[model samples]
Target: KLRERLKISGDYHECNETNSSLLLLTENNTSLDLNISRDAVFGNCLDLAVKKFQKRHGLVVDGVVGGGTQRALNMTIEEKIDKVQLNIDRIKWLPREKNERYVIVNVPEFMLHYVEDGEIKQQLAVIVGDRKHPTPIFSENISYIVLNPYWKVPEGIVRREVIPAMVKNPNYLKKQGLEAHQTWDENSPRVDTSWIYWEEYLYGQKKFPYRLMQPPGPKNALGKIKFKFPNKFSVYLHDTPTKHLFKKRVRAFSHGCVRLSQPTDFLKTISTFNPKINMKKATKRLKGKRKQFIKVKNQLRIHLVYLTVGINKEGQVEFRNDIYNYDKYQKRRIR
Candidate 1:
């Protein structure tokens, strides 16, 4: 009960009750070979074991039992059992996949697996939505790939961010690589800003009737390309301008859409599946800043899923924090 008395603060060669509990917890894992002293010391062996344990559990391998690491260590057996049972029940609820080629994006895991001929052909890291704007779970076929796609800023974003920014500076649109069109159509001529009182919209006296569109380029929110799977929620997989986020251990930051870490690599993989795709031309178009939409002749399905427990590379069972707290409502049931 040393670990029960207190969580390990973390350091090498420290002899304390916390270290004793930490060692006990690490010893129980059995997956890693600590081989260090079990004599209530946070020795080098225990540090190595802690790193391995953190790596195995998808925690940041800092060798320190920080808040995140402590949370993982503190997970009760009953809670883990509930998660396993919930996932077991969840499997039955999933509609059987009919396609031989499909993509599965497990929301909680923040990972995408491309399966072909019953084998996992490719896997890609992805950044999904946080609790506020949780990613929706649904299945849809990706019909086309849009290169240098324009981002039609959502109405909510326009209302909250764009409108407020524009109220202060009318030139905000031009500065952000955005254009205010008279209509939703791209070809619609740019409206004269001076004529309309932009402040009326800020005051909620008049409905903001202009559509904002960001042109295809490096500044595009959708990045260089996007895999489209049309749905009511308008959610799809796409590249992001901020590529650095993928480096972090925890990557649940997006506005409901799934962000791809290796979008170009995934695109190349897709190119192999469809012979009609011209990778050379796609690359050229990207560099030339010319937008192109390529049709995917081969059928491809994208399933956005919710799972908190999954197997790691070594076939070891791993648990993920339910950031969305979906486990609370997803009561396990059997028919």
Candidate 2:
């Protein structure tokens, strides 16, 4: 009954040389084939079945059975069934309130959905954390938006990246628009590099108590805007200066934060949540090196979720690659 209900498109046709591969793949497989004959021909039933399978697994649903669809097809019947069941459980655990608007970042899919009243209002491509620093999954409320924000270098990054670069080239920090401060506080004093003990911090001989921040500019890592949310993981959504990364099919380049492709468009949607925000005036503030923070009157709910499989609007199954190997890890626990 589950397979019968999936909406299928395309007309039935007799098996031809071109469809021989699709025929052998989709036919005689009880998991995907809904009683289709094992003839070496492409027909209406086979086309529908392939489309249904593609949609259910989050494929392009082109009914062409390309490389991605072929990979999905290669999964055994038991594995496919297991994936569906696992995702169904995930659905059951989802937030059930229908009236509330929210944002969802599907990690595996590399996409973000701005949902309002159970419908998608805006959709954008997002770059998530890479394999080394896989994006942590959690829920939080967006508290504010920062214009011309400063990029505070995390400790891990400072140790692994900034320190080494500085050791090789003393002027590296200045060239990169980074400034060293005495402390991490808002009113902390900036420090001149010449007077600081760089060697001690480099060799771990002494604790690095100072903070490194990249001020707002065209070359800034965080681009021009940043969306702040309340989360223990210190992960939030922001714009990226490396615009070419968004063009890639798989965008897992961040250290641990979500990078927005359409931050300005997202800002427009954010304006609706707070009466104090006038997007026209806010756009003017985003210019230059001045840092400005705008707190929202009503916070928006945001969810950073991990789902490799889902059912799309067409009621077809959709699937994505488990980039972090999270599915393998989770399934082991279930077993």
lDDT of each: 0.79, 0.79
Candidate 1: segments with Cα more than 4 A from true spot: 1-4, 7-44, 168-171, 194-196, 203-205, 332-335
Which ranges in model 2 have alpha carbons more than 4 Å from their true place?
A: 1-70, 195-199, 203-205
* Highest lDDT model number: 1
| Model 1 TM | 0.88
RMSD of each: 3.4, 6.4
Summarize candidate 2's per-residue lDDT along 42-74 as a digit string, tens digits: 566766776776656656665665666656766
- TM-score against truth, every candidate: 0.88, 0.80
> Who wins the TM-score comparison?
1
Candidate 2 has what TM-score?
0.80
